[model samples]
Target: MRRVESLDVLRGVAILGTFGTNVWIFSSPGGLAAVLGGGGVVESGLRALSNGKFLALLSILFGVGLAIQHSSALRRGARWPGWYLWRSALLLVEGVLHFVLVFEFDVLMFYAVVAVQCAFIVGRSTRVIRGWMIAAGVLHVAVVGLLTAALYGKDVVGDDAADTSRWLDQVAFRLDNALALRAEAVFVLPLGMVLFLAGARLLRAGALEQSVRGDAIRRRLMTWGLGVGVPLNALTAFAGTDWALVDRYLCAPLVAFGLLGAITTLVHRTAEGPLRRGITAVGRSALSCYIAQNVLASVLCYQWGLGVTGGPLWTVTCFLIVSALVTAGAWLWLRRFPRGPVETVWDVLYRAPQRISSRRTRCPQGRSA
Candidate 1:
C-alpha cells in the first residue's frame, strides 16, 4: 500500500491538536486536576475545544496505520502480526520508558496493547471485524455509562497539583501511584478498539478518495459527529467533574469523527504548499514530534523548570509556541533526513532482530558449510 497524503495531513492535524489538548495538563498549577475537576471559564473552554477529540482522532489513525501494516505483511507473504508483535513490543517499551521518565499520560503503551489485539483481527473477514467492532462499542458504552452514572453528582478531584520542584520526585509519585495513573487506559481500551477498527474500515472504504461515495461518508460523519457531537460535548465539558467521563469518552469521539471527516475533505481539495508540506512532514515524524513536544512542555511547565503555571491565555500561548517549534523542527529535520531522528532510531531497532534472524538462518552455526 502506498502512503496516503491525506492521512498524513489528517495525522498532522491530530498531532498538533493533541498538543493543544495536553498543554493544559502541563500548564495549570492544578495539573490533571484542572482537567479532571473543573477549571475556570477560559481553561474549561480551551480544554473543551481540543481535548479528547484529538486523542480519539489519534486512536483512529493508529488503527489505520495498523491496517496498512497488515496489508503490507500480506503483500510480502509475511505472517499476519508475526513480526508485528515485535513492533508493538518496541512501542510498549518506549511507552514504559516515556511514562517513567518523561510524562505520565503517555498513550504509546496503550496503543501498543491495542495494536496487538487489533492485529489478529485486522485481516479477518468484514463480518468478523464488524462483529468485533460492535462488541467493542457495546463494551465501551456500558463501561462509560456505568462510570458516568456512578459519578453522578460526584467528583474525581485529583490530589495536590503541585509536584515537588524535583523532577525525580514527580517520577516517584507516578511510580507509587502506577495503578491509578494507568487506570484511564483500562477504561479507554474498548473505545480505542472501536476507533481502531473504524479507522481501518473507513480507509478500506475509501473515505479519503475523491469520489461521491467518499464525500457522502465524510458528510455523514461531519453532520452527525460535529453537528450533534459538538453540542453534547460542550454540555458535558462545562458541567463539572461528574460529566468528565461523558465528555471525554463518549461525546469527544463523535467530535473526533467530525474532525477526521472535515480535515480529510480539506486535504482532498487543497493543493500542495509549504504549510501543507510542513504538516505532512510533522505527520511523517509524528512519534518524534510527539515525544519531543511532551519533553518540551515538561521543561517549560513542570515545577522544576519554569515552575510557573500561568492563566489560560498564557497556557494557550505556550501551546502554540511549542507546536510551532515542533513543526519547524520536524520540517527542517526531514529536509535532510528521510525520517525523524526518533523514527530513524526506531527503524534501526526494528531491523536488528530481522538481521539477527537472517544471519542465524543463513549461517546455521551447528552445520558445517
Candidate 2:
C-alpha cells in the first residue's frame, strides 16, 4: 500500500513541535510553574505555540487519517465501521497505558474515544461536516466558559488553599486536576471527531489527492489560519501576560493552528530534500516518537535521570535539542525496518488475525486470500 507521506510529515511536526514547549517544564525552576506561565518571554512564547497550536494540528490530522482509513476499507469491501471501532478501542487501551504509566496529560485515549463518533459520519456531506465542525468549536468555547465560571465561583465562595504540604491534600489536588482535565477532554474530543470526519469527507471528495484542489483547500485553510489563528494567538499571548481568563482557552488552539498552517504550507512547497524526507520518516513513526519522547523527557526531568529540576529557558532548549537527536536517531534506525516496534505491535494485534485467516483461504485467482 502507498504511504500517506503528508500524515507522516504532519505527525512528525506535531510531535517535535510539542517539545518546543514541554522543554520548559523540564528545565525551569519548579517545572510546573514554567508551564503555568511564571517563566519568561522565551518560555511563554514557546508555551503559547506548543500547548494548543500543534495539538490542534494533530487533531485535524487525526480526523484526516480516520477518513482515509475508512475510505480505504470501503474500497476493499470491508466493514469499515466495525474495524475502525476495534482500532479505536485498541488505541484507547494504548492511551490508558500511556496515561497511567507516564502522563495523565496523554491525549491518545481521548482521541480514540472521540474518533469512534467519526465512524458514523463517514458518509456525511461536506456541508454537514462543516456545520458539525463549527458546532463542535462553539461547544468547546462554551464549555470553557462554564468551567471557568465554576472554578472562579468556587474561589469567590471561599475555597482557599487550606493546607499546602499534606500528602493526602496533594493527592486530592492531583485527582481533582485529573478530573478537570478529563472533563475538558470530553469537550475537546468532539471537536477532534468533527475534524476527522471532515477530513474524510474531503478525502472522499478528492480534495487532498488532486493537486489543484488540494492547493486551493490548503490556501483557504491557510488564509483562515492566518486571519483567525494568528491574531487570536497574539491576543492570547497578550492576555496570558498576566495569566488571566482569556489566555487559557483561545491562545493555545489558535497558536497551534497558526504553526500548523505555516509548517504545512512550507512542507507543501518544499523540494522534499533530506530534511523533509527525515521529517517524513519521523512522522511515519509518529506513534513511537510520541511515546518515546515522554519516556525520554521523564528520564531528563523526573527523579531518575539527570534530576536537573528547574534551571532556565535555555536548559529546556537543550532538552529539545536532545529530543530531536533522539528522534532523528530512532527514525534513522527504523528506516532499515518496515514498521516501528510499537507500530508493529499495534499492527500485529489489529491485523495478524486477518493474516492468519488469509493463509487458510483461497482466492479466485488461484492464490491465497
Return the TM-score for each candidate structure.
Answer: 0.96, 0.82
Across residues 1-369, which tens digit of lDDT does each residue of candidate 1 receive?
877769888888888989898898898777887667677887689889998999999999999999889889989998888889999999999999999888889899999999999998899999999999999999999988898888788655856653648988988988988888899898888898999999999989988778999999999999989899999999999887777888899999999999989998988887889889888988999999999999989889887888767778879888988888999999999999999998899999999999999889888765875
Give me candidate 1's TM-score against the actual structure.
0.96
Q: Which ten residues in a row have the lowest lDDT in candidate 2?
A: 155-164
Can you give the lDDT of residue 150 in candidate 1? 85
Write model 2 residue lDDT over 185-303, tens digit each, in one string: 77666557655665566455544442777666666666666777677766667554343334545555554444554665676666788777767766777788778877677666555
Q: In candidate 1, list every pair of residues with a backbone clash.
A: none
Each prediction's total of clashing residue pairs, residues at least 3 apart in sequence or on different chains, is 0, 7
Off by more than 4 A, model 2: 149-181, 202-210, 241-251, 254-261, 355-369
